[model samples]
Every structure is written in C-alpha cells, then in structure tokens.
Target: MGLLIIRLITFLNSQAPETTNYHIAMTMLANYSNLHLISIGKIAKLCNVSKSTISKFARQLGFDDYLDLKDNAAFIENRFNNPLNYLSNILTSIETDGFDNYLNAVTTDINFLRVNLDFDAVDNIAKAINDYDNVAAFGLVFSESAAIDMQYKLAYNGKFIRTFQDDVIQEDFLRNAGEDTLIIILTNSGDYLTKQQIKLGTPRKDIFSKTKAKIVVISSNPVVKNFSFVDEALIFPHQTKYQTHSIMYQIITDLIVSRYRYFNSLL
Candidate 1:
C-alpha cells in the first residue's frame, strides 16, 4: 500500500468507530478509486462536518492541504489498480504453482545467482564501504528493507550506513549529499529511478542531479547501468514473480561484509 492508504488505515485503527474524522477516513478508503475527485466540500457534506474540519482532518493525517491529500490518494489509486504492483500477485503465483514447485523454482534461481554473481563487483563494493566514511542505501518497500539490512550489518564492522523509510526524509538526505558520500541503491527491478514518488505524490525532479555522491546500484535489472548518475551497477538474475529480492539481497549483504572483514583482518 502507498503512504496515504497506510496513513488512513493507521488513523482508522487508532480512532473509535462512528466519529466524524473516522467517518471521513472510512469514506476516503471505501471510495479510494475516486479519491482525487472528492472535493473537501463533498467529503465534509458526506461526513456531516464543516469544510474547516475536513481541512483540519487532512492536516491531522499529515497532508499539507486538501489538494495534497487528493494527490496522494491518486497515487494510491494508481498503485493498487495495477496488477503488476499488487501484493496478491505473489499469492496467485503460489496457488497456481503449488508450494513445492514454487520452492523448487526459488532454489533454482538461488543456485543461478550463486554461479552467476560477479565476485569482483561484490569485492569492489566491499572495498568502497571501507574507503568511504559516509554511505547510504535507499529503495522502495522490500528494497528499503534491504537497505536497512545493509546498514545493520555494516555497523558490526565499524561502518555506519544511512537509510530511511520515508521518501521525503531520504530525499532531504540526498539533497545535501556531496562527493564525500557514497550512495548504494537497491532495486529489485531498475524502475525505481522512474517510478519512485515523494511524499507530495510528485516525481522527484532533479533529485539525483542535486547530489554529487558516487552512486552504486544493485539490481536485477541490467538497464540500471545506463542511468547517468550511477557509477557502478551490480546486476543479479531476475527470479519469478513469486520470489522477491529479500533472500538475494541478504546473501549479497553477507558476502560484502564477509569480504570487508577479510580485507580488514589483514591490517
């Protein structure tokens, strides 16, 4: 789910049932498809509240204004409507393939990665971690989790890596980043540069352009290498739709840290 939907759900959970704000949030979620078109006056009428109350409710949910809320609602609408981005796509794959067959396919993909992964690139990234004092990793959803994993693991070796769950906060970090910092972007597919949206539900225009940090992308999509800001790209084999990059990312993180420690031991 996108940020707006998640915020609405959180609001619903914390609220008592059948209240004004609760009713408004519920209405917004129930009519998620047309949320962008639902004007503040209309929602206020539907929830039997004043327009000012609706505006306050929007702010309570962390939106700058009613229009900002609508923009984010539109983004949520587009994201859930797309079958390719839906979480249930994995469930459908599991049902069709059966559990055993799905496991076998994942095993095969793991073995393929084992045989095909570029050790030189992995070692180079490990070295980069040692060479740079400031490093950060970023991605969307599962990719974001991988970034957190990288940060946690690297800390054991006296290296600190930055990561953020909020797109706005991540953008703020990138805005001030300089050549002294290294950025590692983890993407299951190479589409993050094009598809990522900020808190305002708008494309991050010139976000990378503003940063002078050295960038390295680890992804299953080879096309990430073509991006002008990227200094290095580590491409892994793409697995089936049922499988996510979680396992592969963990393996990559472990290998990089192992190599980092090996090199550090020599000192």
Candidate 2:
C-alpha cells in the first residue's frame, strides 16, 4: 500500500526523476524502525535526497512530519519483518533445558507452511504431471536425491518420471523440450543455475527461453520474488539456520508426490 501510494503520488506529481524516490525512501524506511531509530536528516542523507523532499514525501503519505513517518514505518517494518516471534524463547531454550521452546520453532515453521501452502496449486501441478507426456524433475545436490527418489517412485506407480541432475543435460533437453513437458524443480532457494553467471546471453537465458515446458518450482528462499515462467509454485518456510531445512524440502516433495499419486490413481 505504501509503495503504491508513493508511486502513485510520484506519477501524479510528474515532478519526480527518471527513477522515482520510492526505492530510495523504501530502503531507508526498511531499516530505521522506532527502536533502532535515526534522525530524519540522517535518513534523507542516507537516501541521498534533501530533508525537505523527505518531509514532503512524508506529508504526501498523510504523516504529520518525519517523526510520524518513522513511527508508522516502524509499525510497517515490524509487521512485515521475520515471523520468528518465538525466537527469544527458542534461544532461551537453547541455553537452558527449554524443550517446548525448541519445539515451538518447528511448530512455527509448520504454521508458516499451514498458512502458505495452497492445495489448489499442488493439485494443479499434480494434474499437469498426469497430463504431460514427459515429466522431468530437477534438483541439485541436496535435492537430487529427492528428485531421483520421486522419479523411481512415480515410475513404480506407473508414471514415467525423468530426473535431470546435470546442467548440460538439462540445457540439451530443454533445447528440445516442449509444451508437453512438465518440469518440476526442487530447490532450497528458487534461484536456478540457468539464471546465474555465464559469458553470453543465449547461454544464460536460453535454457528457459527454449523450453515451452510448464514449470513447478518448490523452494524455501524468501528472497525469491517471482517465478514468472512457473505454472505452479509450492513455497515452503523461509530458510533458517537453526533447523535442517532439507527436511522441509523433503516434506514438500513427499506431499507433491503423494498428491500426484492420488490423482494418478484416480485416472
């Protein structure tokens, strides 16, 4: 809402620059909450804009002054911040013998899944798997096992599932892969190797551009914003250092496979 409001105002005013102050202001506001607060001039300086502009920006957003912006931004920041509400307790548990606190962390992640996982998305991916002529599963080292396991399991249950572990093999296959292919990718982070570094344009983006395959991406990375090419995405909890997140990935894999199996059985 804030971003849109600021952007809308910027657009209406038309007095803004090529790249509006939205990103600049948002970056500063993202860090400076009420508790760990800084001065308005400091924020303006950090954003590389004038104090008057900052005040005007705040006033445009209906805040009385910069202080009000800070207070409101603090609330917004806290609201959208990490949902580890039980972290303090979890830490206390670690130092002492607080087992329930530890348990709470697991349950918190479970709750995150409970809220985030859309069964309809799962069903959609499953239907695609059943409908597609070729189902290729991709995952790297940690998830390679899951992909291979899924391939074997689906094949056993009378589904021809393909696993692609090698990037060269994936690129080669994708070069020829088509709309009839359903590509399910399992990654702890949604960032694909295909989207990473390479010398040429064709080498970097070609893998995706060449394929007309429907994509299913299951990932735990919070930073992954959009899967524009993906038909269905089953996102699990954000990564945490305390817990073994591979278990979360594995659980998601199990659910998807189970759902796929059930749907397959129906057919």
Candidate 3:
C-alpha cells in the first residue's frame, strides 16, 4: 500500500503547475470513500475549477485521464478510512502476521461492501432496461458470475438477455448486437475484457452508442467513466484484499434484478 500511495503522490506531483490543485485534490481523494456518490462535476466545482482543468490535473498525475485518477483514488481511499495511516498498517500487516492479517482483510472487505449501497443506481438500471428490448451482460472471472446472474434474472422476467464470458464471444456478441440491445458490464477492476474492446478500436462504438440500448457498467474501479460508449456507471467499493467474493456486486445485482422484476410486474 506504500507503493500505491507513492504512485498516487508521484502522479499528483507530475500535474502541470497551472493545473496543480494538489491540496484540494488530495483532500477530495482522501475523502473519496465518504463521497462515493458525489458527481465529478460537483467535485470540480467544489475545487473551484472547471471540469476540464480537473481532467488535466488527473492527466498530470500519469492517469489516462480524470476518471482514472478518481477511480484509483477511490479504490485506495476505500481500503482505509485514514488514507495517510492506512499504508503503514497495510505494510505492517503484510510483514508481522498471517491470521490476524487475514481477519483484518476480511473485515475491511465486508465494510467496503456494506458502505456502498446506492438505491438511485438500481432505479436507473431498472428504468434503462424497461426502455430497451434486449440486454447483453458481460464480465470476466468474478464478474462473469455477476453478468450471468443478471442474465438469469432478466430471463426469468421474460426479458431477452445474453451473458458473455469469453472475450472473443463477447466481442462477437457486441459486433452483432442489435440497436435495441443494452450492454450491462460487471467488473471490479474494469481492466480485463473491456480494455480489450477499447484496444480493438471499433467504429462500432454504436454497440454501446445508442440511446435506445444504453450501456450500464458496474465496477469497483472508477475507470468505467473512461468508456465513452458507456452511458451510465455504478461504482462498487473494493472489498477486503484477501477475500475473493464480492458481496457489493452481488447486492447491487440483486437490487437491479429486483427493481426490474417489480417494474415488469407493473407493466
């Protein structure tokens, strides 16, 4: 975690002098976990700067852009309440202990999941699906289970949905996706298959480009905002470092499924 903090500090230091608002940005980054639901525009405004300036600040930090910086900050902030002191604890835990370290990690993971529960996101997801005809769910590894779970729930409600786990299969599905298909992606890192799609550089941004079929991303990493193709994003907090299971993802999926089911009943 010292490495993470050092990397973050180095990135902040690299920002342009004119765009340097390191103090305010650091304050915001430090408090990011508490302000999980806050909008980027709001953060910029709070920093007394334009959104583009904030973006530049993020770029200076060696991030691909503002969203990347925000996401990374949020991930690090979520790991510990006190960003400054958390690094020492993290490193110490790594050296002196095993079972105690495991327990702390589990506790952190559970807390992260418990803290992030946004009803507004669930409502938006349900509304988006209600307006679309077909839904395509995509993810890899842990997220694969999330995508499949979403597909199952949607299918049970009589919605046309497909789940894609393999990158090749996912790309093919996206390429052939209809105009009325919504792409739902579940990822914690947001670096796996989705990054591959971006690398492909398809003119078919239209796959996630349409208003009719919008893209909704659920990720712990804030990098979801980097996808111009994505229309909406829901960020989950990164749970403990040790536990592989994602309770927040499961809960968010459940909320989305329940919302869609209820909406369908009304129709």
**lDDT scores in order:** 0.79, 0.62, 0.63
Candidate 2 lDDT by residue in tens digits, 189-249: 5546345321112134536655788777777764443546666777676523334354566
Off by over 4 Å in 3: 1-107, 197-213, 243-245
TM-score of each: 0.76, 0.54, 0.53
Ranked by lDDT, top first = 1, 3, 2
| Clashes (N, CA, C under 3 Å) per candidate | 0, 0, 2
Report the C-alpha lDDT of model 3 over 5-61, residue by residue, as the tens digit: 444454465456454476556756566665445566887778777888877766644
| Model 3 pairs whose backbones collide | 11-61, 109-240
* lDDT-superior candidate, 1 or 3: 1
> Which candidate achieves the best lDDT against the true structure?
1
Off by over 4 Å in 1: 6-64, 74-88, 197-205, 239-241
Candidate 2 backbone collisions, by pair: none
Ranking by TM-score: 1, 2, 3
What TM-score would candidate 3 get against the native? Answer: 0.53
